[model samples]
Target: MPGRALPVGLCPDMCPAAERDLRERERRLHRLELAPGCPGDPPRADPQRAVKEYSRPAAGKPRPPPSQLRPPPVLLATVRYLAGEVAESAGASPAEVVGFVADRLRAVRMDLALQAAGDAEATVVLEAALATLLAVVARLGPDDVRGPVDPVLLQTQVQESFGSLRRCYARGAGTRPRQAAFQGLFLLYNLGSVQALREVLQLPASLRACPALRTALAIDAAFREGNAARFFRLLRTLPYLQSCAVQGHVGLARRAALARLARALSTPKGQPLPLGFVVHLLALDGPQEARGLCQAHGLPVDEEGRVVFLRGRYAEEGRPPASACRVLVGSKLQGRTLEEVVMAEEEDEGVQAPRTMQEGDAPSPRVPGLAQTI
Candidate 1:
């Protein structure tokens, strides 16, 4: 076999198509050299050098001087406006006010996210904003908000905000007391959670010695031990904001305490317990609340305003009605506003350990060992 001729004016390796392809490949190689870090190019002497370089501005080009950036003026203005609205809008329905406050706070928080992380001035504004929001939330009652608020969601927001604030400022001596107080409030709000207790325990001894924290811990212990008398007593001693923080759990504690009473006091023969004694024991406002609590739990009240506990008749099916504790919490405020309450440093009013009742001093008639333990 012999080789065939290709085309006129073209050699085997010098066809017009091949020539054009060679020119195209050479153009690509030339471009690759101009493009930094292109594959198939020789490695640079400085292996760590950036692959791309940005040109400096021309001398005539206007440029901003390097200076500290601040939080947007609009953000601070919005926070102040919201705070003022919350504080001065007593005429507005609490639900409407709380809704506005919550929405504005969320927007403020998002705005804060875009700010520089190391901006201390911005962090201070954020802390103040969070405090104001938390104060507004803590002060409003469920009935006051009239179902506009999801308490659990609000609590989650509080937890997140507090965490962020702590990360930014908890180490500062000026903030340590406030942070400790907030921690105590958090612990009281989650009284039954083992994790909450563990976190409090992990805090420094000095912080744990904080009056609010110590009181909260004692209350937790009382609750775990099922000491209703001691629990209510400690609850009565909390500061206003702290009381507000734990108020949601009060009904639960009361129900649990009542159940314990029923278990201990129930007999084949019904026992009539005095409503006045219940009011004292549970730290209720009055005999009327005591009677109402008993009735709500399916316990009977006699004509004499005493609760009749019969083991067979007691019902444990329904949630207890919320008792009003405004008198208790309000008195503790001593005429402080919500902002003042939230920002105030806790005083060193020594926390007194609740005294254990002597066997003879048990106010209610107890079955030999059961009442002693309760």
Candidate 2:
């Protein structure tokens, strides 16, 4: 019995398929072993298991797979971390932290957009995240930081978040309803998207009745009709939240008007635009402010308080990025010369244009007086 050889294929005949596979694997593993490291060595780790073990997060701090992640929680964590940090804390500046959080929220926004395509719950979460972001912006006011914070990126992310909100609202129209419409109206106005604003104006009368919607519509009207006097008045009277939201865009709109005026009034030879004219056109307080704005934009102003239009092709390039919003607004107004739009609105409404416009006055009937709500 000791000298007897086992029959060929006996193991395969005697064992089940799974047992045979295990035995064969064990035999191959044994063959690869250089030596018996110990009388009973621990079982070798599976190759896949080994990789997973190495890749796994640190012990006791398991993270959900990315597919299972919910963005709002991540965003909240980032915000909370920043909120807890102090001046001497080992962390980024408040501005940097805010910017980083904004970027993360924007990414979450895109994720929300995708999720909202198929799930209503995702839409709700997206809105909550957006609200959180808006609060973050409010808390990081210009005066809050010791160092200057560039709100440009934060503003951009907010605008993009509004876009995501808009999409979610559109998708949830059937199950959700008027809420999305009104919120979207606010967002489109905040974004200063004139074309979108016009489209929304075509919504039902009930939406038009909302104070915020009414305000946004009036602003759009004032801007489109070239009623700088009226637009500025309405801009100042905006509801508290809307006022803060549109501060950047209002500046952008004014800058755009200035750029257009420059291009229109500039001649190949130096022609100075009257400071008074520029002020009235851009809804500025006075020639001094007009001069300041011109200087800020690199437009030369003579000692006589007249803006000297640049000589040639270089003039267009002189405009800032904010001018793009102005151009977009202008195009949305159907390329009407500012005067034409203003005059046409006045004529069509059977209302006489103000004989002599003054600072902070309503330009037409569509614009409310200083004390009047939009």
Candidate 3:
């Protein structure tokens, strides 16, 4: 084999030294393929696993402790401003105040979400912030505040904020009283939805017994049953903040109730219903608003200020009268500024506890003169 030349490609297999060199070359290629960034068939690896590894903190460089984390400076400032100066400002219209507050609260919420992770104190702050925001939003009626933001969008934000607050409560972040109150408000705001009622029913017996929640449940029942009389009656009993929470739905409730009335009262020869009766039934400000509402829905008003309901003539058109019944709900604020109305908790420590009812107990009597007014 030394004297005779081996086949060109067979030398490595035929000679020991050639075979050793070939083995060494193969080993070098294998090592090169395994090295970082070297061009070869990439190692089969899970992409998610790689991402997790990359995202993980480097060894010996742990994350800062939750105790060291503080809320953003802007968040603190904004909250203080909202609670103090803005709350007391008398010159700004309700819409303007709410729009500004909404913008600031949105920023505060975003900052809290980023910085409040794992920090109990910061989470509590977030709860308060959300509560304040919800309160501000609840103060405005559905059509009362209009601008770039749609009224429906504001309601959506309220729902989202309340949901976040509930999540916080589930983690034991907010006080029970505040959470209970907001839960009731949530039910009232979503009066027409069965889901809201289901959520309320699923609550603990103690929470379900809160006065606000109880009233909310009654209102929901009346609304679902299309009992306009009972719906307006129950509506008159809500506290100022609760009224704000429920005000957004008042127009819809009124429209639906008016439709029912039209269907029931309409006759071949139009029937004349007193404007005063419509006012009492809908809790409107007075005869003028009642007339407006009747006209809005295509009903005719007579010289004597009576609405003529004609069969097959009721048109489901026109906007409902703007809420003008300040005496019923808005006046309940009793000269308190919007901020005080919003930020004040009904059951603060050392304050009187909310009235709780037993399962079989009847609701407290309605304001005596309210019924007579009708």
Index of the highest-lDDT prediction: 1
Candidate achieving higher lDDT, 1 or 2 = 1
Q: Considering TM-score, where higher is better, how would the candidates rank from best to worst?
A: 1, 3, 2
Ten-residue stretch with the least lDDT total in model 2? 47-56
- For each candidate, the alpha-carbon lDDT, in order, equals 0.61, 0.46, 0.60
Order of models, best lDDT first: 1, 3, 2
Pairs clashing within candidate 3: none
Give the alpha carbon lDDT tens digit for every residue of 162-214 in model 1. Answer: 66665656444444436566677768778889988998898888778766777
Candidate 1, poorest ten consecutive residues by summed lDDT: 45-54
Model 2 lDDT, full chain set = 0.46
* Per-residue lDDT value at 284 in model 3: 83
Span of ten consecutive residues with least summed lDDT in model 3: 46-55
Residue-level lDDT tens digits of model 2 in 1-374: 24543221111111123432453456432211212243333334222111110122356864333343334444333333323321113334545545544554554454333221343554554554454455345445334344555667667667676667666656654534334333533543455566677557666576555555555666666666555556665654443234434545666667666665555656777767677766554545567777767777767888887788775522334333332222223222344332232212111322112123345553333322221221
TM-score of each: 0.69, 0.45, 0.67
lDDT (C-alpha) at residue 72 in model 2 = 41
**What shift in Å separates residue 170 of candidate 3 from its native position after superposition?**
1.1
Q: What clash pairs does model 1 have?
A: none
